[model samples]
Target: MSQLTTHILDTSAGIPAPGIAVTLFVLQEKEWLQLAAGITNSDGRVNNLWEEGSSLPHGLYKLHFDTQEYFERNFTASFFPFVEIAFYINSHAHYHVPLLLSPFAYSTYRGS
Candidate 1:
């Protein structure tokens, strides 16, 4: 299994926000380097953002979620075009980043 994974839930519709583009990045010095990209499945999950059984160097990381396109596809008005969650990885522990989203607002926490 990958050490990193993510999912998104649309609070407004009470369903997984599928088909949204997501990008993973790691901070090196002052630049954000793209690591991998995946789209949300029907369950709003991307479980292979990083290679399985491999270790990631301790650093700052980010996940960029494309929200505007998701809302447009569903014909809804959204306040934020996208959401970026930046977090630090200091150990080799499993990381789960989850997004709780609405058209007008969103929140994320460091999940298990």
Candidate 2:
């Protein structure tokens, strides 16, 4: 079975971006449909974006992070209201998407 997970690190504060909302979507036929949603935990991770025994089909997927709310709660000014990471998941393997975030910038990559 395949699994999907994510982590969000607040680079500016040097901590996990806890309680931040994240939504997962699958692109199908030119439209995006919500597959799962989770909030970052104390460790700045969402370990189970998908069910344990479930697997996602090979396709394009996206992770949307609500950076505005996170920044607002921390009383910081942000240039990006939100961050969206779109990537391809092509096999029955675990996908770890980690986000390195700051008030003004963010980056994401495929992790082990």
Pairs of residues at least 3 apart in sequence or in different chains that clash in candidate 1:
none
Candidate 2 per-residue lDDT, tens place, 46-100, comes to 9988999888999999999988998899899999998999999999999999999
Candidate 1: tens digits of C-alpha lDDT, residues 1-112: 7899999999999999999999999999899999999999999998888999998899999999999999999999989999999999999999999999999999999888
Sequence-dependent TM-score of model 2: 0.96
The TM-score of predicted model 1 comes to: 0.98
CA displacement after TM-score superposition, residue 47 of candidate 1 (Å): 0.7
Off by over 4 Å in 2: none
Cα error of candidate 2 at position 76, Å: 0.6
